[model samples]
Target: MFARASEDGFIHDMVLYYGKTTLEAHDVPLKPEQEGLGATSQIVSVLASTMSFPTTTAIFADSFFTSLELVRYLQDHNCRYTGTARDNRIGKPQLGTIKEMEKKAVPRGTCYYVTSDDGILAVRWKDNKTVILLSTDMGEGPMSTVLKYCSESKKREPVGCPAVTRSYKANLGGIDKSHQVLPMKSNRRYLRLFAYVIDVSLTNAWVVYKRDCKALGVKCQPLKDFKL
Candidate 1:
């Protein structure tokens, strides 16, 4: 599912598939979670249809949608991912704990990357809090740094961050924007589903329309006007 940050509240390119089947009731080596991970990879494959060679695409997702397995899957497909991950996820790096880092006098905005046996890079950074990110598409060097306010220091300072972190922070807003603009708050489940389909369609169309207008150097039509 694709969502714009805080604007449309619409989920785009959503594909639904049932998990339970007569075959599933019999013999399957993979666990249900593995099946779900495979399904998620397929969704990403569908979303990457427009991508071409040498033009890398990055997927940003929350912890629920990210794992080392998922990172490898995208890497195999020539894509990259940046997402929050739980510490316990399999193959996740044993980065130093927040306490350990604090004890070591690690400064805010400091970032470290650990490469797994499979060559996937896991990034750990200290901000207001410790953040762990899994990535396949980021380089070792920091692309740029940003000034982030540190409460302890009571001042803002330039913090070095990896490219994946920067891109994730920038692009993370699409889903949030979608949620704000077209909130899918319906009591009835069926109505909710119906609203989701409509809202996604409308939001996707609007995004394309706005992009085309920008490319052509024309003013974008208002949402009301575009809907008409």
Candidate 2:
């Protein structure tokens, strides 16, 4: 399953299908449960892969999807996973009860095979501290293995935020010759589609600006700053 975001950063539609074979692709419309963009994305990616074959499956997630619901979702569907859990809140996973993970004498970067539903894990890549990586068919123990796998990825270079405002005379963020805002929505569908379109247009503009900056030595700025 997969989803396309609307102009307002909402997932207006979704597609769900199964991989008859590896690397298969299918599409479906958005469901009510996917009102939130984040859930829509999670459901789409997971459903797309597991709905077809029922075997030892592996899924990966960043910090956003490390929660009870997501964990239960994967378990209910019969799939293995390796996702980064937050410590206290966003990236914070409460590091208690996992005392067992700390007793070992493994090196910081050494893999600690994590094997429980939730426990402490030392992310050797970050400050070494026990964290959670709930999984079933863990290749190594629990904590270490999860950390090693999660930490193996190279550190991403920091990127600046995008400029969202536009400088075009026509405030037409979407299109047309008029410098005015979007049309007032007469229906919910209109509102949803309009918001989605505006957001996508904004994002597309940012990407273009960033690309141009990289290629033409121009500084990145908002559309408002851009003169026609």
Candidate 3:
């Protein structure tokens, strides 16, 4: 299943992947470009269509869901997006290759970036390893520092980090947080799918309940207590 969640762990939408044949049978909406980019990009487009507030929503996806075409599409739709990109998916930009960026002579925080004609910024930054990030909403400037443990130094040292990278790391854990509360074991072995669905439903309900409680200034029950 493909899911979109808020920064606080509220699942806003989900799409079950059953292959292109099933998607076509269901008449899932996909633009010409989205179709050409393949299934993962199509999923991102479908999820973007379901956004309650597209103009105000900022999407953060991992390399699995990010591509230059996807970033451009989201920008055209007026939704901001920031995500790490696979080197192959970032299009042909005049940036240093991963090997060059990872050389021992290069500084730890070295960054190379390029802007497309349509305003997509592709950045390659070196930390412990090279990370390629794409964004329609951020740039290389306004850099920040993050603490990383260095093996040679045997202590944590501050490394410069791009705003885009920092933001992605901070906000990409919403779905992970939601997954933490899901049941790991179930009694219905033969109906595991059904059990999994129920677990997700209950988790979403608890999130909504907590949201409402906070809005009304009331105490909210813990997930375990709420389930009981």
Candidate 4:
């Protein structure tokens, strides 16, 4: 499977067969009634069960897919992962409450991070919002700047945030955009899946066409025009 983002939206070139193949390779029993698994853990378990990563690889995910347990699991396999997490998730360090932080007036662009004994990096940064991230591969400091909307200035302002956060902001939209544009709604499950596959194929083609056109210094066809 491939994941990417474009004007059309977040797209993943997924094959259902690959999911099944991964499951089979791991000898995962075909049984239900699994309990004591948080929703995030189940998602991570599926990914970890199916895929093996090289030591240099890093996986990035959003809050819904992130947990300290997942990071440790990936680390145990010599892989790295970076992702945002909810404040309420278990196994995370007990940072001060959000309300207390607000009362203390945590400044915009302020960031704090702790490196666990096991070397997991947990960071908290305040922009217009406060976001917490867990990573096995990110440094404890900001190495880049990003443009964010400032309500007081009524304009975009550059603020410094961690490099991992910068990377996440840049690539997080790929899946979201695909969901927005690919309007697949069919009563039959198989038909809906078929349409989704076609949508991904077209999007991937568009990406390749745009890349090749750019490299050749040729005028790129608009997606709408290319669709014709």
Candidate 5:
């Protein structure tokens, strides 16, 4: 069903990374009673750490990541997840098939995926103002948190987190079928990075700064006064 039957159909994988921070709690027990690891833990670990663990986090995986074992692991560790589940995963009328879901109402339960350890989840959907989101987090009765992962706002990446504006003038490379594209200082995350650095350096005087320039990383060019 994923692939295109028509000649012009297209398919591609969707991947994402996100962060969450809001109400925090001290180290409770890394279990259900846990409030949170506070703010820093959310930034340093949840956002930065790449390693997966028992309590790493509960991320709403896409179809490629819909697995019962992964969700159960997060549940056991106090994390949570929700996402568009897969079509396979047999048994359980409550957790029916994808085709069944299309025929049923918007917010219908369907058997989505299973775990290696024999765990299964009944993926459910809910209609918000915009569109309906499907997930296995029916226990919360139905909520909307859209960050591409972990639809639960409470479990999402820390909110109001400062943006880390790091830059490098890397080559987009190859022929664009146009004139040669020369390298230019560009703000990857956003523009104005150099301006920020300039403002900081102007205020500090002693420290010089540049943004997203590979050449500038090793050593910045000394300012030369152009005598008119």
Candidate 6:
């Protein structure tokens, strides 16, 4: 399943994975450039179409749903996106190689970034491991500091973190949080998808209820009580 969720864990929309043929049969539109992309990219495109354009909706996702083409597509549609990217999916940007980034001589917080002509930024940063991120709305500058445990010194120390990385880390858990609140139980083989759909419906309704309560200045119950 693929879902578009808010930072506070409100699920806006979702699509069950039914393969490319099903998507085509449903007449889901895809740009010419997006035609041959992987299934994950296609899913992103379909979910994004459900959103209103030019709202500056910031999308945060993991490597499974991020690619250079998808980032470009989001940018063209006036949406902002930041996500971890697989090295191969980022194209041959003039960024450091994994070997160079992992060398002993390199500093732990070292970072390199390059912006494409179309204004997509690809950032490569080193912490305990190398992380490559892509963004349409962030830059390399104005870095933030994050606390990291230093095993050698046995103390926690501050490490420089890129803005894109920081944003992705902050916003990437919406779907996971949504799942935690409305977990689905194991069911008979044919009933599994139906159970998942019911859970998602309940979660979305619960989120909207909480929002309405807050807006109306009314006290809200916990999800368990609200469900009852």
lDDT of each: 0.64, 0.40, 0.84, 0.65, 0.30, 0.84
Ranking by TM-score: 6, 3, 1, 4, 2, 5
Please identify model 5 stretches exceeding 4 Å from their true place: 1-57, 89-93, 104-121, 126-228
TM-score of 3: 0.91
- lDDT by residue (tens digit), candidate 6, 132-212: 999987788789899999999999999999887887788789888788877667758557778878888888888889889
**TM-score of every model?**
0.74, 0.33, 0.91, 0.71, 0.28, 0.91
What digit string (tens of lDDT, one per residue) describes model 1 on residues 1-228?
332132223344343444543123322234444455645444444444334441455667777667777777667667767787766653646667657655547877677778887678787777777777887766556557889887777998788787878767776666666555564788997897788777767777677777789999999868866433
Worst 10 residues of 4 by lDDT: 26-35
lDDT of 5 by residue, 1-228 (tens): 111011111111111222332313222113332324333222222321232342543343344444444444445545544444344422233443445446635332222323323233443332221111222333322322232223555454422110110000011111121112112356573444544344333423322233323445665555343121
Listing every candidate in turn, what is its Cα RMSD in Å to the true structure after a full C-alpha superposition? 5.3, 14.6, 2.2, 5.2, 18.9, 1.9
- Flag regions of model 6 displaced more than 4 Å: 25-27, 31-33
> What is the per-residue lDDT of model 4 for residues 26-97, given as tens digits with 9 covering 90 to 100?
344323422234555544555544454448656677787788777776687787777888887626575655
RMSD of 2: 14.6
Error of 2 at 9 (Å): 26
Shift of residue 223 alpha carbon in model 2, Å: 36
Give me the displacement of residue 20 in model 1, in angstroms.
5.3
The lDDT, on a scale of 0 to 1, for candidate 1 is 0.64
RMSD of 4: 5.2
